[model samples]
Target: MKGFFDEVRANLRSPVLLAAWGFMTAMMALAGPFGSYEQIALPRRLIVWLGLTALAIVLATAVRVVVYSRWQLRDFWRGGTVTSALSVAILAPVLRHMAEVAGDAYLIVPPGLVEIAGFVFCLTMGFCAFRHALETVPPAAARAALPMAPADPALPRLADRLPEGLRAPVLRVSGRDHYVEVATAAGVASLLMRFSDALAELDGVDGLQVHRSHWVAARAVAGGGRDGAKMVLRLTDGGQVPVSRTHLAAVQARGWLDQT
Candidate 1:
């Protein structure tokens, strides 16, 4: 949960989020819905709308993280929908009251629940769309940016499930009965996912399955040779994985077997 709130606070610093906030705040200030254009002075209206939208964006981020963590929902459109709905449900009434204060109830009827929801949802969706666009970098381009580079929030899909400490270069993935264990410089973590699916998401990661249930990054291979009758690949962490007969040819072609 600590990771969750940390993500929310981090959103405030995003260029995309900041741009979206500024755009929405400016639009709201100009349009002056809820009678704020008539009731409040121009400068105060801008300030009030800026504060309102900022709060909404923060709330939407909190809702987004909670939903994803709990339901594992990651679809772009579906996530935006859930985020807007849940956010409106949580913040609409508060916004309506605030809008009334800004609009001055004595002069105008403020804004109804439905009207406030529409305005909030529109701004939230705008923020989400901008964030998604920024994160949609091409896989090849992403790979060109090496692990030594500063940590990118848009890591490989598999990294999303890893603990924060394990964000280093992924060393390997080993499949057990029902989960895949991922190894990184910091440590190892297990994710409840298919071994094949795990390997598929690791595009441009420069690795291959050395056996039916084991994949190793080229950079992580210390060497390879026979441990008794079984051919094995030694890892940087002093761990070893058996190289199966099915993948022996590929491993040999890559010259990994000669590294030892």
Candidate 2:
């Protein structure tokens, strides 16, 4: 349920979604499927169109939440089809009600047919928007190919800061508020140490701070990829670390970016 709301929030903030809604509103006003385009005043036409578009978008988002929660379909196209169909089912009656309120009569086609067509058009637009949103580089697959440095028996002083069992080959160190989360070959452990002090203790380990909050071992980096414009590094332990813009040039200079 939390995930569903999160998805809804994300979708609402998407630029592609906003653009789609704008396009739909314009088309609804200009096309005038239920009446002659010039029959209604421009202001009234725009108001009606905007209202209907908002209603449809809200309902479609709700349908997506339900479909995604109830049906865990892995295939993208198949899942989209089912969700779109369900959205249309919820859209039909609301569209009719809005049309009647706006004093528009179904012109060439029945109200039902118009509603179906409108819903289908909206669904197609949504699918395209999502496809654009999902266009991200796959995680780096070359982590295994990278050579690992010799495991030094002399543990870095940073090991003293970790729990006894977690004092192994550190993969990454991430800052979380006042604590630092240390990921190692053994497992993950959190210690209440200042991030700067922790970095000073790891003097012998070959690693770099990739982000304001993240420091990753050079050998642990599997490869790199792009999530939209942001750079990401895949670690041997199957963790993805985001590279901040401030540190991107430094990471690239080390040949880490080329590995992806």
Candidate 3:
């Protein structure tokens, strides 16, 4: 149960989820579906829409917790789709009941059908919005455990900082709170070194710091793309590195942005 609440808190903390809620609220206010626009004042309609959004988020979070705990479905889209469907299923009927209790007029369709259709439509919109948000938000930094690389007599200083087995071609280095996560062809390892110090060790390496917390090898960059307002460099290892606003122009100047 504690884990369930923790997951819910994490979801709610997501900027993407919050943005979706705001967008859905505005759309509901304008569309006035379920006779909400005509039956209530603007302020009340906004409040009701906000309440519905909150309920949907909570229900979806709970459903996600169950799906993940019992079924072990970890894929983002798959879990989100299930949660969205369940949320709509539960939210639609509850909304209809609320409308009846409040004595609000039904829209063009019967109250039950109207609530179902309206909630489904809004949820769909929210899902897409959240998906886009996920694309833009940077992933959490973590090092993957893998076997070490073969010994190289001429290993660089940066390679020295890594563990014995992980001395392979560097892909990228991402800064955690107090550690630097070094990604290589062999695997990943976290070293207790400042990000700036790590970059200094790679003095002769061909790479650049794209973000405050991220530095990527020039050879490791396979392509690039736009994620909302940010530019992302796709690494050879299938990792995406976000380029901060401060270094966007520098990345573009270096032709990294032209790859994709």
Best prediction by lDDT? 1
lDDT by residue (110-207, candidate 3, tens digit) is 46756575667457546744653443212224223434345465455677556555678787988876667788877666566789988887757788
Deviation (Å) of 59 in candidate 3: 1.5
TM per candidate comes to 0.57, 0.44, 0.46
TM-score of 2: 0.44
Candidate 3 ranges beyond 4 A from true positions: 68-70, 104-110, 113-118, 121-125, 132-260
Query: lDDT tens digits, residues 91-208, model 1?
Result: 9989777666645543467678898789778877776676655544334454557354454654566775565556677889988655677878666665657899888877578887
- C-alpha RMSD of each candidate structure in angstroms: 10.8, 17.5, 16.4
The numbered model that scores best in TM-score is 1
Pairs of colliding residues, candidate 3: 148-165, 149-165
> Candidates sorted by TM-score, descending order?
1, 3, 2
Pick out the ten consecutive residues of candidate 1 with the lowest summed lDDT: 133-142
Model 1 root-mean-square deviation: 10.8
Instruction: State which candidate, 1 or 2, has the greater TM-score.
Output: 1
